[model samples]
Target: MDAMTSKGKPSPRSSVRPLSNEQVARLGERHNLVDVTRYYPNGPRMPDAPEIGAQNPRATARLLEGVSIVMRQRSRVKAWGYDRVPTNGPFIVACTHVAMYDVFIPMMSIFHQGRRPRFMAKAEMATWPLIGRWFQLVGMQPVERGSGKALAIESESIRILASGRPLTLWPEGTLTRDPQKWPMSLKPGVGIIALEASRRLGREVPLHCSATWGAASINQWWPWPRRNVVSCFDDRLPYGDLLKDMGAWGDEPPKELVDELVRRVHLRLVALLAEIRGEEPPAEGYWDFRTMTRKPWPQDFDWRIGSSALATETPTDGVIGESGVDPGLNMVDKGAQS
Candidate 1:
């Protein structure tokens, strides 16, 4: 979620001036933000935002779980590999963000398996009228995407893990821009969290990758007449073993570790997606955010039944029609993560 001030604007860091250590200290004490000066002087910090499941009692979480159950029923979601979810301890669930409907599918999957999920969501979502309110009630973590709140988000995430709660993250940061709905290049933040959380718990954290396709079929929050197919890759990436291979036990691993960690998860996600599609994944594996230029699947675009004729229509610059499709050359310039 984006960090907002009393004025409901971006935090001061949104300006060119860098944040100070004292400011950082205040954030740490308040928002559960982590101080990682040695790693990144101007790195992201956790925002001092309210989280639903962060410190609340089980009663609230149960209520949210009930909501998930109802949503699953209404959506008629079909999920696979849910039994593979580890029920005994805290684990990381990295998912693909194809459409808005993607959120409900995993929540239902994990909820059906008897676990509540704390999602790392965008900060802006917390400001949306009703959906934002629901997000908080469900204990989703709101994070400012590129306003440099990564460390702070990680701090809160570690706290959640320490509390023995399952946390879900969309490592692609934002909705995928892969026109074909393939996975995008994975971000290293998830790797950082997995590595650090494993160290803090003094045990390896199992990282599970789950991919949901056809969400676009039920896109735009419309659940009727479409069913989502979810695949939970049973093979959990043993982050502990990966750390051991890099000789990073009990200490902060080198920065390079993030790359390897992201690469592994990205590959696994691609493979799982291949299984869902019953075909070999692209030889290139996934699109790299640094170079790829594609538009996100429309939030209201039910690609399963909707025609691309509207999508292909060319429009003038910076104006979207009623369907929210750019209709112009819908290329996205690389910006901050999500």
Candidate 2:
């Protein structure tokens, strides 16, 4: 609870920076922008441009407003877990990307915990009119996702961590289309980052993996939406001297060592899912003919089945739903504590 307030102050640090929801919304509506990014000031600059990104006062507020809109218009999501997040220090955060709004849980949680979450986004997202400018202003480093660009990302991550700012990343690369896909797989980019940070900083950066359950699914929208909950789990991967104890070079090898660290994170997430449901495992592949129109699975687990690709072809939009006016994600409904 003793997190330094210096990091918690809203970006832009001025009331006149035009980072408000109303202003951003008006700009987005008129410009047809769906996403925005802000880059934080890397060095001193004029007061007019002042700072961007992390300093972009309106980014978080506007995003929160948008999230609230989705909650009201779409399904409900009962959220939980600000108590578990840390208030300070530079750590590497790994979260399971289950939905598009997954980014918000960490961001909002940190907001409540009095810390700002710094995340990495794709470089191309910078091209979006209003959205890109926001990200560029927020001090978020852009990484090209793929093998060829891996070094660039690894190097940037090392620098970010060295600067003593915690980094939050969705190690899964992409959202699992089916949460039932238990620990199916993940890319090792996270490992690469950890390896580099350890070698450069002479310390193991704390790595925490998180998961969210019942976050409003694909069709969930704004105004009065369905409830969603996010439960997070954390563990540490000692990088500093742990690497020497295990005898590894740089951060990339022994592949087995890195694999185990990654797997442990996955296992922690799997346990969280099982614990939340009080079940053996998710019915991820539990496709049903009745749900031929969608990726079917009930809110409460029952109709048992396993590992079967649906024989029936369902249209993607079959389950598409319109959101009502619920201000969805905006309400941090710390429903019954899990």
Candidate 3:
């Protein structure tokens, strides 16, 4: 157990802790504990999972078109790259979750860019009455929570990837609501699925980061709207190279590849968020989340993305690997918009 003695402030360490084996057993029990099956016995107790979201290209494309009409008339918001996302693919769209709106606007942008996005929603989210149904309609699926849930998510994600469709997942697991003030951390296990899929498909899966800024809340889509910008990079960072450049844990130079992949995503996320904010990112020592899977940084190791380093223009020459050719351009088929 670790403890900080200097302050009365709440520890940045999550209060959510490791579950005991007994707790795990209890969790399994509670999974179907109050079986509503007795009353509705014929069907599922919770609502059906959604399939229309980031997964259903046709629906997302249609939805984004409508959002574009609304955004067109709005003066405070700016959108970039409604032209780069692929219309169909086995790709991963990594996004930053700051505000609740962090999701919708980006989805709208990607939809306009020509790819559909499927995202993981909390299991509780699926149980909501009307809103739950909407999530399913939009391709949102319930992600069973807890450490044990990782395998379940991984299994489902591989199946999703195999379908040759795109899926959006938060490595952060949830939003980085106050990332600037504190360390923005992400769960490291996310890389496992990315790597497995690449190995199974015998190709590096496509990974891209879309960072957002200046949006207030997710629900404030109406009114004049807050000044916001959605930036998409055509970076084709590979599942393996991402881990390599980002520095994941390794033993024989390739075995801990999953650790390496997660590490890379964390590193890139730091860069992406820093670029979006146009500010110096928190120091490496302060990035507790990234350090979760690797060695802690020395005090002088800088990780901040400074204003001097922010890309004034998107990188035309984006990341690449053994993949035949990198699609590192701001050009997705406009037919994707339809």
Candidate 4:
């Protein structure tokens, strides 16, 4: 067993030890008791299980739209690319997430464009203090990260898109872990869900790439008289043909197929980041979140976006194999946000 130090801190040897079920249970009543579920059935009972979220999404969408209108006005937010968004049908809006507060940017932008956005958000949001219920009422689908419920989330997401509402998902899943905060490698679930949605609809669901910068200012707790721009790139993906071409439309998509789809999305995200920064990006590669060690943000107040050194880093092998790992669907380490 690993030892603890005199200061109540873990010893160096105790840093990353694995625990048995019995040992884990003995650590605390919360861990030891399953009887707590009798009182709080949905409250962290079987904490590792995947939760699919509340039923009845359309009703929630209605309430969320009303709430976002007030938030939009207060934030003084603006959006570019109304022409780029689809006006008549169901579509997928894939965006880069830099800050949790910035989720409002996409919410307001899409709302003003005449569509309600159904987000595939973290399951914890359903139980967050004040806004947890609001999240459920907004038709946000909750997902337990890394519980192997990605396919469950994808199924629900496809249903939301089929309903003709714009479904917004952060392909990065979490904030950019890049030292420079440029867009990182995207999770493949967005591509997979878009493909599946298009297959169900008998046509391609347009995938719009959105990049939101300046939202980082909100993290400093002084958001505004300053501006936050939500830029929706003009490039839209015809996912149906792309999927068929890559052989992803079959009963089971191969690992290479999904990787290629994610790669295509990553390239476009990099281009969008370059456009937002008003500078040229690295010639061939970007920082891979799976393998890169992220740098912490500055301690003082600074509104500038973080970025990485322009090095040609290749994606690490074995980081994600045929069974694609959805890091966004995996555990969230909120340290990246700070």
For lDDT, the strongest prediction is 1
Once model 4 is optimally superposed onto the true structure by TM-score, how far is the C-alpha of residue 133 displaced, in angstroms?
1.1
Index of the highest-TM-score prediction:
1
Worst 10 residues of 2 by lDDT: 1-10
Q: Is candidate 1 or candidate 3 better by TM-score?
A: 1
Those runs of model 2 whose alpha carbons end farther than 4 Å from true positions after fitting are 1-54, 57-81, 177-183, 216-218, 221-225, 233-241, 246-253, 282-338
Task: Report the CA-based lDDT of candidate 2 relative to the real structure.
Answer: 0.46
Q: Against the true structure, what is every candidate's RMSD? A: 20.6, 17.6, 15.4, 18.7
lDDT of 4 by residue, 58-159 (tens): 443444455555445434333344334444456777777666644666654554333446787878779989778877665577876764666777778888
Error of 3 at 196 (Å): 0.4
Ranking by lDDT: 1, 4, 3, 2
What TM-score number comes out for model 2? Answer: 0.58
Prediction 3 TM-score vs. true:
0.62
TM-score for each predicted model, relative to the true structure: 0.63, 0.58, 0.62, 0.62
- Candidate 2 structure quality by residue, lDDT tens digits, 178-211: 3243333445667767765755666556666665
**CA lDDT, candidate 4, residue 313:** 26
Worst 10 residues of 1 by lDDT: 34-43
Residue 92, model 3, lDDT: 79
lDDT of 1 at 313: 38
